[model samples]
Target: MNESKEFLKEYDDSKYKKPSATVDMIILTAVDVETKARSVPDKVLRVLLIKRKGDPLVVDITDPYKGKWALPGGFVNYYEDLDAAAIRELREETNISDVYMEQLYTWGKVYRDLRRRVISTSYMALVDSSKLNIKAGDDAEDACWFDVKITLLEEVKTQIKAGYIRKTTYELSLVNSENEIKDTVIVTKKLEGRTSKIDLEYVNNPSGLAFDHATIIFYALERLKNKVEYTDIAFSLMPEMFTLTELKKLYEVITGKVIYSRNFRDKMEKQKKMVIETDEWESGKPYKPARLFRFNPDWVEDQ
Candidate 1:
């Protein structure tokens, strides 16, 4: 018995590895036009999250993660096609109707899950905020929109392109054609008196969805920041037509900068990918209604 124990103790443990997981991204977008170009605001700018309802038999469902809202996502099924899993997760959890979907990224990290090592692929989708009537589906307790709070100095709005401190705060609310809604927990972020750059403050989630999801959400924000440059994803949030002021605000919100009007216009015109439609309607304010435009049908894909 002693000899057998000694031999077993020499067994190599380095080859032992945990099973991996696949994650599908439910990328949400809103329309934001800056000058002549319409773009999608970064995920940090706008997103739809659902509180998870892990319980299977609860009637009318009273779930802990149910009341808490986060993005609609889940683990991939065995031998399942990646795209199919994303569709299943969306339909079953968010009850989201017809909308365009696409692959965003794959997230597989050893330490991403605390219980075990797993990897997930994040998928993206674009939807018009006004176009869809969204509801929480089977596993979601509640569904709500949480605007990503990024920092822009009233001073930074006046000065640099990226200097605003992306602070966090609990004050969060958005009003739509429906009614007022609240999130599970409010995130509070603050800058320590004009620090040159921004840092994450604190996020509160009462119905934790196991693993590094909070961190995954953070990663999505970075993806939005990059995609806005080449794709018109932000426009998914805005009205069909808007003034230059509204357009600039959209950019300021995403790019985190206060832009000079002339420079912004000049840069957009050169893109030569936007079209001006002849219909004009004013906001009935002091300024004249700016010319309404759309992506040049042919130039959009190329752009």
Candidate 2:
């Protein structure tokens, strides 16, 4: 009986030795802006990368994204709440504040970290980059904005196809039009990239960065797709004020598809969640004055 009791004690104690994984959020934002009277949509996806001076997963950024491109993350401190830790990591890596932040995903692949089994309690933040200045801090080599490129090329992903189906009889004009049916097919021939190819390169490739952050870039892209439709997350990346067209464009970048203005706005604005600060007009653009708005945190209060 004593042996069994001791065995149970060891098993219980073993759980304590296991390192607890932490949460790291991938912050995202959609910024709507006015350009030449036409609204332009841009994503508020910033690189929260710092330099890695030590051991971890080794990756090659190639002739692109080199030097300064990695994720904004850190070891979760004991006693720090996961949400608080994610926000702290964001602030520590990027010298910016007062933006929208939320949990994105938990990246816990055993090989995600080379030095240890770091199960990140990841979070995502959206900010108006045009409104604040960012810099490298802590382990970050540097920080900057890189345009995201989401590829929908035919060669890359499976094409969704639709067509009418019909059969012909042996006799002329005996085609089976009466039995016509439409068919849609997804050619799962080639494997889809683990994540869609969302590419981000340095606005200026001078600063040296670290890691497989492009993967994080892709992860952010995917997160935005689902987030914009449901949450007020898109506005986190937009300016304090914006126009409808610009809002639509922001939706496009997040969804990887073009959204019709009227229908898109009908759905987008109705979310009744995120709103903009209106009565604001053109900044420096020469066009019809468009209204602008900022993200409303109230829509997300207690949410």
Candidate 3:
């Protein structure tokens, strides 16, 4: 025992290399926009992105990917907790804080970062943009909310030596508040039947998003789609009070599908604890006012 204690006292952690840790944020919101084709307001999904300032070094090499758009992130402090690091990095880069956030995933692909060995733990948040003031700070050159639209371009299935592989391609379009196309990213994801796992890679990303952030955004969206069905997380992006139609539209937008009104209402009715009818209604509209409803805190407690 004394010999082992002596060996431990002389041990050095530097003998084994360690990967650097980082935290990235996916801040999402659903905003109401006026459209020429519709009398009522249309809800659009938006994501916050930051432009990199100064020169970026890629694996000890200065690369052309510098000064491109990327998610708000930074290296984690040595003494900080993972969740605290995520929230602190988000606030430092975007000037937005105190929103609903949860851990999304950890990305540790060997080549994900050209700079050193970096392992990133990402967090996802849903916020009402109107309530918070946002600005670019720290290493961020500029920050803006871009309207996000994802379209499935194609899906292919191929037989490999071991098993079957499914490949799907998606086009991600980022539009500015002025409704102009700011950037477009094409990503392809592959699912292996043998492992039942999916991996994503960039096909043609003109947006020049740093690292594997484009894939991270897509993964976060997929998780949100699944969570909205079984959880009250969707309410985080909604206004304090909204009509049933508004809520339904929000769900459809996130899921990228149109749901029948009757069926959706039926599901909502069955989950009576999820929402409560309020006496307030939308005002200053051409048609009859629609009743407003708020999310029930009781349901959250039950969950």
Each model's lDDT comes to 0.55, 0.52, 0.80
Stretches of model 2 off by over 4 angstroms after superposition: 1-17, 20-25, 29-46, 54-68, 153-213, 268-284, 291-303
Q: Candidate 2, residue 16: CA error in Å?
A: 7.9
Off by over 4 Å in 3: 1-7, 36-38, 55-60, 160-163, 177-195, 204-206, 271-273, 300-303
* Error in Å for residue 181 of model 1: 14
The window of 10 residues in a row where model 2 has the poorest summed lDDT is 168-177
Candidate 1 structure, TM-score to reference: 0.63
How would the candidate models be sorted by TM-score, starting from the highest? 3, 1, 2
Question: For candidate 2, lDDT tens digit of each residue in 96-197?
Answer: 666666666566556554455567766666665566667767766655544444443223333434322222111001012122111111112322334232
Candidate 1 segments exceeding 4 Å error: 1-20, 31-44, 54-68, 151-210, 283-288, 300-303
Report the number of the highest-lDDT candidate. Answer: 3
Q: Arrange candidates by lDDT, highest first: which order? A: 3, 1, 2
Q: Count the backbone clashes (under 3 Å) in each candidate.
A: 32, 35, 1
Q: Encode model 1's per-residue lDDT on 175-220: one tens digit a residue.
A: 3344333322223233344555433322443334334455455545
